[model samples]
Target chain A: MSRTIAVVAAGAMGAAVGARLAARGARVVTSLDGRSEASIVRARAAGMIGVGDAELAGAEIFLSIVPPDKAVGLATRMAAAIAAARTRPVYVDLNAVSPATAREVGAIVAAAGATFVDGGIFGAPPQREGKGPAFHLCGPVGDCAAILAGHGLDAKVLEGGVGAASALKMAYAGITKGLTALGAGMILAATRHGVGGALLDELGASQPELLARLAKGIPDMLPKAYRWVPEMREIAATIGEDRPESAVYTAMAEFYAAVAADHAGEERETALLMRFFAGRG
Target chain B: MSRTIAVVAAGAMGAAVGARLAARGARVVTSLDGRSEASIVRARAAGMIGVGDAELAGAEIFLSIVPPDKAVGLATRMAAAIAAARTRPVYVDLNAVSPATAREVGAIVAAAGATFVDGGIFGAPPQREGKGPAFHLCGPVGDCAAILAGHGLDAKVLEGGVGAASALKMAYAGITKGLTALGAGMILAATRHGVGGALLDELGASQPELLARLAKGIPDMLPKAYRWVPEMREIAATIGEDRPESAVYTAMAEFYAAVAADHAGEERETALLMRFFAGRG
Candidate 1:
């Protein structure tokens, strides 16, 4: 009674999860008809079989891991694929979209008579093979938790339907990434005064406990800010019109984008962001 | 061989320092002919001897501890006393004024053939007897550090001239106090969304290090913010036209003033300010 898992649009995180599942003996198929060469290489390296549109019909689980802007379109495509299949598969829209967007995707999969699960990834993929990050899930899938646990992956079922998982990610990212932007802004402003060294020393002396945490946490978080920008914007949109804290993260995305554009030819955007803070740029 | 120490316009901090010196067997005298009864009472409690204008002419050390706006006028009055003195005393200006103002005071004292020292206090008076806060001194006065050390008080001599001691105090206060104001503003803004609890919990979970400090620091510092408003403004002026970080503290002063005005009841102002943040006001 083996189950076939179809991972659509396999990139870094999707490929990592699919690779782990395939290595653990699940039949994994990835559709790579229009993906980049880098993504194709990553999917093949994960030991996933390249499949055509018709081959996806036999999958028991269909995971959509496209960009936030494309989540609804991908969900519509997956819904059409289920309609064409001999047996419908459980469809999970794991992209970083708003709760409203998630509901739209949920309606698409529901119209096609397939189970819809809302999922979000909190951490990055493992560098090697066996270990991977937790996948938080919610929505109208009763046995998804047991299924995920059976595969040796951590999964948490949150409250509400379709939107709660995205809300948690949005709230968590707003503060962590917001603080990074704040520290960068303050440090740069202080340096312009020719008293940054003095200010840092004074902070250490007067508020040693706060300064200790800020110095350690801010620099460590800067390198990962570029990757988190889109996710932060998605979280902001999910929180909707009333939450201005979401706007704070959108501002952070702009800050990181500027940092990315400023240091174009060096390392990855994340690495260059860190180097700018360290005074290399 | 005993030296007379004159403390002009004795208030909370001035009286506290004078008392500490008096407790160590130094003769402490204060001019109290035109001062308010509250100040006279504080001077008596701090062990300062009330002296007439004539008696101030024989003192060996003169300390001007007046308001920032009144510093120059008080310096002029002290200059008349210095001119009448049988033997010149070492003059110290410990008001929260710009460096230019201190230098103006320096010119007055030097014209009367007296040694001048610029000084600033970095913390509140001791709650109990026989203890004092850190005091910083600058300007050309031989063994000023040794004289302060002899009084059993925490004192340091900054080498960067008259402005350095004030600059150090200003820079230190700006960050420690500025961050507290920033935290309060953000927390209040988040409360508008009716999800402050969720936001705080998320902050604690994602950024435990920063959130822990903000919770403890902001609440403790808000009550004392009223007393700091005047000094912060003086610091802002002392940093002069080039430093924009100074404006942050000036903005905090305005915020504290608004909170203070809203909490106008003499007996319940502190409690009322806390209630405002708790959303009960």
Candidate 2:
């Protein structure tokens, strides 16, 4: 059975995942009204049909893939179109937002008369990696995951209501990204003290695998740092402000913010980091 | 020719490393004047000769292997004795302290007419593991490393001035212990939000090794959480409070402090973590 699927915004993950569905004979429609030329090109290349915002509600399934900061805004933007449709689509939010934010989005979508699935995507884009990332879904998932899995996506239903998937996502990312920030912060501090080389040397001798991971992960993080700021804050929110550990994510947000600024500015700290991580200044 | 080496206040690491040195024919001396009975017993079992504080300066080499909080106070206490001795021993401060703190200790030792070597130990004690940890040294080391190396300890010299070794230690511990705190924080948060099992499931599927590390580390961290408080603070001091990342160590300190309290109190959080990590609620 061919399903009418609307993948909004046509970003990297969206376009890639949409291509998989389209290739598997699903009619993947996307709204590219305000997206960049690059995004339009990606959507077109991925065999997705472009549609107006109002037409998005006509699809049987709606997948929202956007940045953490934009997750709420996107849900609110599509609420009116979804409410006016004859049959409300199963709307899935697959952004890297906290459980709290997921619940908030779920409420907005449910109020608009759609069955909202709280979701989180793990791993890289399928098109680029040649392997699809897992799509974890919660909250009255029904046949939505099966539908997506039938179209070549690795969609799985997690046990719990709305916010379960996001909680897992927040916990997972908090460790991975938090470690990266800790590594970068300590390495930079070591460099400032003129012992960066020694730190790297000791790590190479002692924790070689961890050193290699930081080497690879830190550079890969530079471009994506701007997006990570809100995601870190989301993790902080997931942990809640009352907890002492919440401050870790807040610091990570601030650290990423600094790294983003460093990357955008003269690239002084970025170059130092690149030199340390990638052996290039 | 065997050298006389003084290893102060025999804690776990001190007694083990002292045992290794003692076994290898270096005369290991320690001051048990104010140490716990357990410490004194360990020192004696390690074959370390107990000497009065006044006689500690008479050894050819003095190794300070106390906690980070006690490093400076020990040095200050021993300064007058070192100054009054006929021939001052080469003093080594091997505690986990900030570079700033290391330099401060260096100044105090140098003022007492002893050649001050900043040092840091990596790895577990030799007696427990049957292998020695690396002893990284800086500042006019001057046969201090060679003396330890000759006695079966892996003593290596780092390049730079007084603070190099401490900087490396601070950086390394910051990453290792900091990651442990971050993992514990997120897992506890997930458990609080009723998604801990889901988080562990996802981690097992994606990051098995990291999950295993947390399972082992968070349990191991409980007993040592009290000691890590000062070490984390030293790392925060090393990073400098002006930097955004410094807050990470502060948060880690606070998190560990809370965990320590939890471990001491009703053990609610501790039991939850143990159930998640060790399957023993």
Tens digits of per-residue lDDT for model 2, B1-281: 77889999799899998999999999899999878999999999999999987789988999999889998998899999999999899999999999999998889989999999999998778854455778999999888888888898999988899998998899999998998999889889889878888777778887787888788888988988888989999999999999999998988899999999989888988889888864322
- Tell the DockQ for candidate 2: 0.83
Residue B259, candidate 2: how far off, in angstroms? Answer: 1.0
Candidate 1 off by > 4 Å: A6-12, A31-45, A48-59, A62-79, A86-89, A93-98, A104-114, A124-134, A199-224, A232-247, A265-281, B1-211, B217-281
Task: Please name the candidate that would achieve the greatest lDDT relative to the true structure.
Answer: 2
Q: Highest DockQ, which number?
A: 2
User: Which pairs clash in the backbone of model 1?
Assistant: none
Q: Which 10 successive residues of model 2 chain B have the least lDDT summed? A: B272-281
Backbone clashes in model 2, listed as residue pairs: none
**True-vs-predicted CA distance for residue B258, candidate 1, Å:** 11
User: Scoring only chain A, what TM-score does candidate 2 earn?
Assistant: 0.95
> Stretches of candidate 2 above 4 Å error?
A128-131, A279-281, B128-131, B279-281
